[model samples]
Target: MTSTIGVTDRRALAAAQSSPPPRSSAASRRVTPPRDALSVEPSVVDELLLVCGVIGTTVSDTDTPDRIVPVADCLNWLQDLQRALRRDDDQYRPISLLMAQWKIVPQKLLPLVDSCRYDTDLVLTVAKILVILTKPLAESTERAGKLPIETKTKTTEA
Candidate 1:
């Protein structure tokens, strides 16, 4: 069945079918700004470092070190821990080597309540990481069907 198009619908259809304004060569060839230039916030490296520090301090079962060496050392230790965790096959051999190299105790993997300056900072940093990791996934989801589309419906009174 054919439906009658209202004035609003006609106007919208006409606008959609009309040709867009022509652009000059200079306007068309204008250089777009770099993506980095649009960013108004600090880089994620600091947040990543903070997260590494938090995880490192917890794994080391020691107070946060005053020097940068300890922090770097802690980061290495965390990497080792991650590798160990992922080593499902040949677990014994890898764990033994990790234990020998870092002397890590899996039992003491818990973070103390007062380990970091603030728990919220860790939470926020972790959230930032999650956002970064899931950005592509989120974009794909949006492309799939999450994007909004404008539509018009007509009503008739008898």
Candidate 2:
């Protein structure tokens, strides 16, 4: 037996056959600003350093250093993570290293809060580092994904 289209089907077919709505003029289309035209926020850096400290603590059981040397030492490992977040570089080994370190002691990052007072731009650069450091590992839950991430407590000497 032959079946006829139902009222709903007819209406849907009619709608499909109908012409599309009027198009906006090309000039009316919205233009996206250039990358350089956009400004990065400062608060992101606070998040960045916090991520880095989490990564650092996760790596080798070292407490957050009052000085920049230890932090700088992490530069090589953190570079990849930085590039991933900052979109400025090609290498990601630094980030890989930071991940390796973080995998060792994942829980250690819970206490060190971000409380830095530097230029918003500078903090953003650092913030980029932190975001790249934690996100990938956070996405994984495999045994091979422990990521050197540790969760512990310690004290630093000045």
- lDDT of candidates 1 onward, in order: 0.36, 0.41
Cα lDDT tens digits, model 1, 73-115, are 4434444445433441221222222232332233222232134
In terms of lDDT, the best-performing candidate is 2
Query: Model 2 residue 91 lDDT?
Result: 27
Q: Candidate 2 — which residues are off by over 4 angstroms?
A: 1-65, 69-81, 84-116, 136-141, 146-158
For residues 18-77, could you state the per-residue lDDT of candidate 2 as single tens digits? Answer: 968667975455343333222223343344445566334322325753323224444444
Lowest lDDT sum, 10 consecutive residues, model 1, at 88-97
Candidate 2 lDDT score relative to the true structure? 0.41
Candidate 1, TM-score vs. the true structure?
A: 0.21
